[model samples]
Target: MSNAAVLWRRVVAEAVGTGLLVTVVVGSGIAASSLSPGDVGLQLLENSFATALGLGVLILMLGPVSGAHFNPVVSAVDWWLGRRTGAGLTSRELTAYVPAQIVGAIAGAVLANLMYAKAAVSWSTTDRSTGHLWLGEIVATAGLIVLIFALGWSGRAAVAPAAVGAYIGAAYWFTSSTSFANPAVSIGRAFSDTFAGIAPGSLVGFVVAQLFGAVVGVGLLAILYPDAGRAADEIVTPHTDTTTTGATT
Candidate 1:
């Protein structure tokens, strides 16, 4: 296969993987709200559990194709960390991956809404614009970046699916923002007015905080693992180049 074909396949994998992830998140949130009624705790439990499981499965399924980077921040961090070493996504790959992830996320939210008999594009009214929530986003995103890179540096990329899923599940409970660490996920959630939604007005702050957190995470990685960039190709999981014979870890 040609390099362009490989890139195209990877882009499609990222989009489809991200779309399914959002579907799991939004769909489960809708289901939880309906099943639990006024009990917010139970609703959250259901939502978090389903999201964790679905995310892990998606990563395991698509990591080999696109590194399963359903989050733009993740993609950006990968590029930044590996720019000098040429170990992570190229500039072109980053450009393609980010847009695909965002578009897929929006489509997933719309699909979730239609599945539950809601309007396809109802803007979320759930306002999450508090200082503490912004802090929560920063902390959540930073931790996620750290965890992903740590795994790669430690040669434990094989366990990323479960570890990443578990971290997000725990962050959902610990963070005030329910851990919308992914910019794509944040944007996608704004399209729904369901239990998992975030208001459109809150998007700017959340995304900004997430980007800042990525920077912080990278700084921390430099301190903890000076050679973390060497493992960039294995982030999220080991990515196999279709034109080549083996994984690029």
Candidate 2:
């Protein structure tokens, strides 16, 4: 097959993987909320487990195809860091991946809403626009990016499914905003007003904070493992993990 065809396959993988991931996240949150009414803690626990397990499974299933980024930030960062290494997405590939992931995320939220018999396209009114919330997002996203890239550098790519999932699950309780680490996820979650949604008004802050976190995460990777990142040059840089999803969201 041609190179374009290969990239297209990866693009499709990203779209499908991100879509299902969002669906799992939103759907689980809805189910958890419904089942554990008036019990916020229990609902969160339920959401976190389902999200963590589903994310891990999706990564394991689709990592070989698209590196399982599913997040625009992940895809963009991968392209930037791995460009010189030749083990990353091409500019063309990067362009394709981000939009596909975003579209998939939106679709996933809509699907979840439809499944639960809610308005399929209404904006979320969860209003998470606090400064501290943005700070939490930055912290969560930075930690995620740092973990994923560091693992790739250390040649422990196989641990991603478990480690990434665990970090998100843990970050949920620790972070005030429940760690909406993925931009695509933030966008998707904005569409739902249920237990897992974020207000559209807060999208900018969240996304900007995430991007800032990505920068910090990548910088830390460069400083801490100056030589380790070189190892990712030869193999596909598998910096894996995401901020959005029921588990982390």
Candidate 3:
């Protein structure tokens, strides 16, 4: 396929992936909150599990097309790792994916609102007394970048969806930030008053931490697997069609 076609595919994949991801995250949270009002924590746990599964499946389904970015941070990290698509993306495509993700996230949040009118849409605010939340964000984001680089290096980018999903679900409980790992998802969740919301001011800290974490993750990958950079120069000859959804988790 031509580079232009590939870029367009990437944008569409971002939109679909973001839309689906938001639907799963917000929609499931809304269901859990309604069904188990007294057990908000458990509801979040349930949502995380489902979100992980959906993420894995979506990755498997769409990784071949658009490289299954779904998250701007992932795209940025890929660029840093030297694995972003070539002609590579111009500022225009980069701009396109982020907005697509943000808009798609908003659509998901809005849809959840329509679906669960009785439930709260905005996330709750707390003092965040646990200092671990920041630490968790750092670790989670770093781990995410490392995994992406590793997958790309091993020429197993096809399974990124499942790999990412599993990481996200596991990280939710393990990391203090509940693995709000993706910047776009974090921003989208802010729109809802549901269990997932991040306070308006809080986004800055979280995003900064995530960016730091991504840098740390990729930095380590560079240190540990320096040869991967050389390997990255070779074009990845995709075995499946761009639209193929047979990827593994």
Instruction: Specify the highest-TM-score model's number.
Output: 1
Models 1 onward score TM values of: 0.98, 0.91, 0.83
What range of 10 consecutive residues in model 1 has the weakest lDDT sum? 240-249
- Model 2 Cα lDDT, one tens digit per residue, 25-81: 899999999999999999999998988899889888887667788888776777778
Q: Candidate 1: misplaced stretches above 4 Å?
A: 247-249
Using TM-score as the yardstick, the better of models 1 and 2 is 1
Clashes of each: 0, 4, 10
As a TM-score, model 3 comes out at 0.83
Candidate 3 lDDT tens digits, 80-157: 555443332346667877888878777777677777774435554633334577778889988887786677678876
Clashes of 3: 10
lDDT of candidate 1 at residue 240, scale 0 to 100: 90
Worst 10 contiguous positions by lDDT, candidate 3: 231-240
**Candidate 2, residue 125: how far the Cα is off, in Å:** 0.5
- Candidate 2 error regions (>4 Å): 228-249
| Per-residue lDDT of model 1, residues 100-218, tens digit only | 99999999999999999999999999999889999999999999999999999999999999999999999999999999999999999999999999999999999999999899899
Winner on TM-score (2 vs 3): 2
